[model samples]
Target: MEGIAIKLNKNISLSLLALIFFLIGLFSIYTEVFSGIDRMILDYKFRHLQQEDSNKKIVLVSIDEKSLSYFNSNGMYWPWPREFYQIVTDYFHESGAELIVYDILFDTPDFDRRNLSGTMSDRRFLQSLKRSNNAILAFKSTENEDPAVDLSMNNEPLIEHYNIKNDPPYKEPHLLTSKPLDKFAKAATGLGNTVMSPDEDGLIRSIHLFDSLAYKGFVPTLSMAAFLELQPDTVSLEWTSSGLRIGDQNIPLQDNGDYLINWYEKGGVRNGTFPYYSFQAIVKSAIQKMRNPDAEVSVPPSVLEDKIIIVGASAAGLGDIKSTPISSLEPFPGMEIQATILNNLIGNNFITQPPTWIAILILLLISIGIPFVIAYSRPGKGAAAIISILFAIIGIGLALFTYERIWFSTGLYLIMATIAYSGSAAYKYFAEEKQKKEIRSAFGQYVQPEFVEQLIAQPNLLKLGGQKKRLTVLFSDIAGFTSISEEKAPEELVSFLNEYLGTMTDIIFKHSGTVDKYIGDAVMAFWGAPIDQDNHAELACRSTLKMMQKVKELAPQDTNIHSRFGIATGDMIVGNIGSYNRFNYTVLGDTVNLAARLEAANKKFGSNTMIAEKTYEDVKDVFYGRQLDFLVVKGKTKPVRVYELMGEKSDPDTEELEKIISTYQKGLDFYLNREWDKAMNRFQEVLSLKPEDGPSETYIERCKKFKEEPPPKDWDGVFHLKTK
Candidate 1:
């Protein structure tokens, strides 16, 4: 029955610990501390996953450092004459390219304003766009102002198809606030916004399809505008519960009407993953071709056949660099990002985020499951369980990403599982330590310090039964405690007692003595039971002498305080001895009773410390002591030999102290032999040697009493105490 109760308690404590860990895990997940970590893990997965091929139909013409250097060498800086773009566009149109998309905006007139030869460069650029008929010009929008265009010239098909007034996909949005000349805007195929919205982590992972115009409904993004140009007729715009529909294609839009761009390839690699042509090289080739029909070009004109050209800067000085998961420190060009978006639209490799409900459910499962598994498993097994869960979670995430292009938040689950498992382990460790602390608090004073630690390690050692062993016991009390207590008030008396007892207890513990109990001002202690000590007798005697010395140091100015000690060594049963609910560890036998009586006997002997003959024998070689006399203590039948413990043999004043002891021993010898005058003279001589000596003065009075009224001739040397 007792065993069953213990097991039940153990289970209950484990359950409580598991619950605490689960709650903490839940809080961490709820606060989205794992969100950023999850995103980072996704980035890693994206980098390691199988690389996708770049769109064959798309090509990037970068205005890179090589192009900048080439142009600068020709005495021309950037924002080159619009004639450059005009010539490039004309060449692409002539090369059978389906579309020419300019990521750069021609929002203002040329600064030179000087028409060369027949026409201004802006008019020539506009004429080139009209000739291609498939050119898509990029523009930007601002919420502050509308573009200075003829708002009456409507793409009526866009407005009439879906007349949803003031909707997010159609209302007061980033209006096209900048534009080329009105004649140029009117002649272009279509104007699209080139604003790419990056996620909070500064990676352009997606693009909004269009930006709303306050006056003209909405304007499509560059990719969307190009797609529209491919359609022969105006496509209908339909909004359903799922997403927006253009023509027969259903476009899945996020909550904010943005498309998640599926990046096709990594950046910052040899040859990258996309075909790139230097803009200056292409322009120079085109100009040379226009001048001389058979000029050699850096790139073959056939490469642009049926391809969509993207014109944007890739030079670091141009500041078009953007952060992507593929290259963090080294920025990916914005032109490449747009090319990816365009390719994503064509390939339909858009990534879809799972609903919030699924994320919450996964969080709940991990938070509860991890802690429970770890808390229930055996210590080492818990770590294995955590590993298994971690692998399973990551595997599931990778499977989803690989097979379905779905990105699951595996990082959060892994972190939550790890934290919950670790928290459970920490909780168990601290809980065990707390139990050990309680054990130490309960029995620290009653058992030797070493035994207290042992009890913490092996609690079964604490029980009711004890074994009989030869041990040393000590008892100490203030010699005149009654008189001292009578002089002080209750508060002052408690303060005084605590200070003295606290100091004495520290000394006892330092010497490895078990303080058995404190009875009023008296302290009972023992050694060699809880923790075995071969020199328990010596330790007890040494502690008593130190206590006497410490009391002298703490002596009051108005009155002196002294401590009396009695120590003995004998066979005694030591362990818990009392009622079951209120038991204490102590020694019991004649040895303990004799020690107690010896402590009281100090009142009659005028000695600070006393020890049994057995204790004296054990420490006789290491200590300096004086043989006092034999005493038949109260409740003890046999007369036990006693000694007055002075100090160790290494004491500085031992030589002088031994001389006084010799004189006192002589007086004791004469008194025991019933020599009245001789004993009195010897004690007087000892007193003359040390006039303030208590033992010598005491023996002097005893000799006087014996001389006045001598005992019978058969009187033994044993002294009897009338009071205990």
Candidate 2:
């Protein structure tokens, strides 16, 4: 039986290990073939963990549909004059706005300039830009292309102070800026590129922070240019191994220096995710506030005060909109992306993936641990465990995202764990089924079918080595069976014994106890092995009491056959024992011997049940019993307290039984203290409570004998049993 179980376990273990490797290989394939799903997982995580934003320090002065309609109704054309933007600029400047960033690029001069000559509409916008202390203009860049306009001295402030090593090349090609019109560019405080590149999935998740030029060095993007203008003096840029650092904040980057933009808030042009004001409204407010300095302006001066303004086209045809992880269905305006980027940088909020080695370690750990958990747990329990691990990984991912601003491929690792658990559990089911068949075949005759099933479920129980464990062992025997067997026919005796053993075996199996063996009209069993039962002592006592009840129902009325039981709880070596060819699962050591001795001792007191001190301690509160005596049973040197287990705490007549126990305890105490006369009287008192009480009657006899022959001075309370 032991060998078969060991061999089966080895097979299951090998199968589980193979499944682990298969899961890892599957994960590799998943990442390579289904990479988009990974992004989908990231998007889900981002949206799920998003929090509401209440502050609006940065605002957008947008040329939205409302502004377009308002302007066109007042006779302004679709390409509203640059002079209108100049008025918006003057409004923001006078309203105490900190900085203005143009998301719209002015790559060429205004087309209607030929008709309106002396001081062109473009020149008016240029003059307005020159007067502002914090106005930044936008430009564009493309691959292998140079600027259409001339480079000016004004863009020098936009150049980075430190140089970065473009190692292993960047993901995107390096291109120089196509500067805005020379006159307008020179008039602005700073120049930044307003170029955007979408991900392969057509979602704008990252942006190029610096455009590496062929000879003119690096230029900032429009958002970054605005940031530089905010901290022109205190901020110093430096190159680092991971990315570049502006002051103490590190800008994590892809190899090509494109930054993964952290969308600090959700996107909606009118959702107040960021403050929004119509471009036409700001221009009108500037005129209103200037005309009547004390007038109550709808676009209040306090609203734009100290705010960094982003100027962008939000009209359907004018603005460039891109899909994002959060706004996957409704496109996100390009200017909102810039505003989010600037918001992220100004607050030093960034997200990065863990190092490759850390990610691989997490993957390996989850994959390896999952299969082992599934292998050891029961089917339903295994599924629950795997699900718990799945959520734990996701929780860790969310914590990383929330507190550390880090993102990991938690979804992929979770897939690896799930695949490992499911595959290994499926294989384990078949493997255990084979083990169960072999167990039923090999040990069916030796043990009950229920025990055999348990052994199969936990195959480790069938190992050949013994483990010292605390168990409750019981020994039961029919009293005076020798005389009955001699008088009865051989066939009749065998039938009676089988009937008795079978009924007892059923009772034991019903309570989840393992039946060890039968010693001819005697039965032995134990609890707390094959499966760990913390309440082993209580279970053993309960089973013994039930077995006592069951025997009466099975025995004939004419027969005087009755069973005696002894239960002891202590450390014993329990396991399969025998040669490799044939083995029996049983227990050994002093605890077992004491239990057998206890069974035979029952005959001396005419009692049906006896239990050792260790068992009593475990069940004192729940089982009704009294300490019977301190006895040195055969073979042992130390004295042990023994008691009779009457019934469970729920037994009827409990109050009366308790009163009888109290009187009996006093008798035993007096007997122990060598007060023979007092002990005799107390025992007599116990008999009055319940006539023919076995323990009290036995104690009365001992007290009378002690009175006649007083014990020697060296005599301890322990009664040494000379016979077993």
Candidate 3:
């Protein structure tokens, strides 16, 4: 229940966060278009340059890929009412009385696009778009639309899209934006079209079809080069109104009243001549070093010298941005509609539109076909959406950039994909968190509290395997336990031993020791690995000392037994050492055997605890100890110097034992010299001070034997015990 509750809470929190992002995505759609219009129309001066000596003559000015970088991390923001606007447009207007067709929108008038305050009016910019005999300005038809106008434009059909590799079939790409046909009509005596072309992920992907206007019963876009380039050579025709004559070419309106375009193919690896001018640099050049507000300048009469100029933003952040055909770097101002119109007029080239069947096929395949693929794709692969969106956007952009009129869509499919991916990810996150909570709660109580945590953090460690390590093993027995058991009733004896063993075990565990087993009245434990400790020797000694004090206290209460402890230190295999069906975390080595041997030795010495030389060597400096013997513990060949731990640094003052220790050393030296009678005399002296001496009794008996027949002449004082 607790795990479930935790999982539920986490899922609820993540769901709320996902909902917030979803709403933000909806809101973003509306705001994105406003930001985009600025990018579309920055240079309205140098556009519509196909018609010479006409009131509609204009030049083409590009905001270009470079100008878009103004919105980069280090860009100068809120572009002021700089010389860019004043010089380019003002010069053109001053030169002659021509119509100013603005591809730029003046929706929100601000002095500089960067700063909100302390700037001048862009009314000067807007008024320029509105002036002259043939001036036309563009705006959207989405006055009553939602934040973003998700207009679906009627498309020209797709042509061939295939490859040799076993690739997926083609689909119709979505439209970027609906062109405001009504607004276009109001803006120009000769209309310029406006479109918002979106890529697969709702990014602007490209400039739309240019030759679209030549189809029957259709009007041309605002961007045709012929419109600006040909005055003598180009003809202007009104539907059902007038016959047209352009240069040496004469055109008559068809019965359906649409003009056909004569297009020339420009093959791969080369480009048709499209002259580019930087809007920022040109505006700077126009205003630099000019003294007079109205200075007269003359230019040689040429195709674009007297033409109308259109300006627009081409920067990605400026919002007119589109993933382009040539690269993902394509962009054009809203004013480029005017430029495209001029380009078409000059070249007499136009795009061909496919029939309704083709449109239906493209739309059906893209919307239905792509979604089916996306829906059926394995949930594990997130890049399916990315690759789908990229291939579609880049494919369509390259097609348009290459002048292949394939009905392409990128933006709409991306919206559907975002919903799919984000929703799936959020759901999975909640599910996985729940699984973790379940595992945590399941084994929590069955294992040691920390063990469960370790298992959860690293599940692989629970496998049945372990490594060898150096360790200190201890064995302890209750001194005189059999006599106490015989004296007491069964209930009393069992209760007494339980209380005694329980206390000792607590101390061992408290000191980071692992309890190995219990033998009737004995305990086996070890320290230093089940997670290694650099101070296993120290910890073993410390646990041993604590056990002695605790068991001594146990003795007075129980009156049944006193504890005998033995400790030894050496390398051991420390881990789960048991069968596949049953297991125990334990330590085993020669050190363990010796520790048990030392416990039995404790009985011989009449001491509570005895440590082998291996253990004493590790901890001698920290405790008050005496060399008890130089005897080989059972199961060992070499006689080892063992010690009896008198007390630790914290044990209450041991001045008396300090004196006994000094006397014992003297007595021990005398006994080792083969003078049995002399050794007996010194042992008898130690007994005089402490009557119940245990080690001295053994020395006295050995002396008595030596007095009768003496030890071997080469006896080395070290007693080598042959068994463990």
The number of the candidate with the highest TM-score is 2
TM-score of each: 0.55, 0.59, 0.47
- What lDDT tens digits, residue by residue, belong to model 2 across residues 429-490? 88778878877875675455777778786777766556789999999998868878888899
lDDT value for model 3: 0.53
- Between candidates 2 and 3, which one is better according to lDDT? 2
lDDT of each: 0.76, 0.78, 0.53
Question: What's the count of clashing pairs in each model shown?
Answer: 0, 1, 90
**lDDT (tens digit, per residue) of candidate 3 on 42-61:** 11111211122222344555
* Model 2 TM-score on a 0 to 1 scale: 0.59
Lowest summed-lDDT stretch of 10 residues in model 3?
159-168
Error in Å for residue 476 of model 3: 1.2
RMSD of each: 12.4, 11.6, 17.9
* Residue-wise C-alpha lDDT for candidate 1, range 1-724, written one tens digit per residue: 3334445676676666656655665666567667678778777776777457545888889899998999789777777888888889999998889888888878778656334522478878888999998888777666635456455323333322233333445344554456655666677777677777677888766677766664656667778777767665656766654466666777666555667666655763245666889987788778888888787788667898899888888899998888877775345888787777777667666676676567767766766666566655667797888888889988989888877778766777777677777777786678668868966876786655777888787655544455688999999988778888898899999998898888888888888888888889889888776767899998888888788888888767677678888888899987666654555677899888888888888878788788999989999999988888788888766888899988898778678878878888888899898987888888888778877677777777877888888887889978877789
Predicted model with the maximum lDDT = 2
Deviation in angstroms for 2 in model 3? 32
Off by over 4 Å in 3: 1-334, 337-471, 483-494, 509-520, 527-539, 556-560, 573-585, 649-653
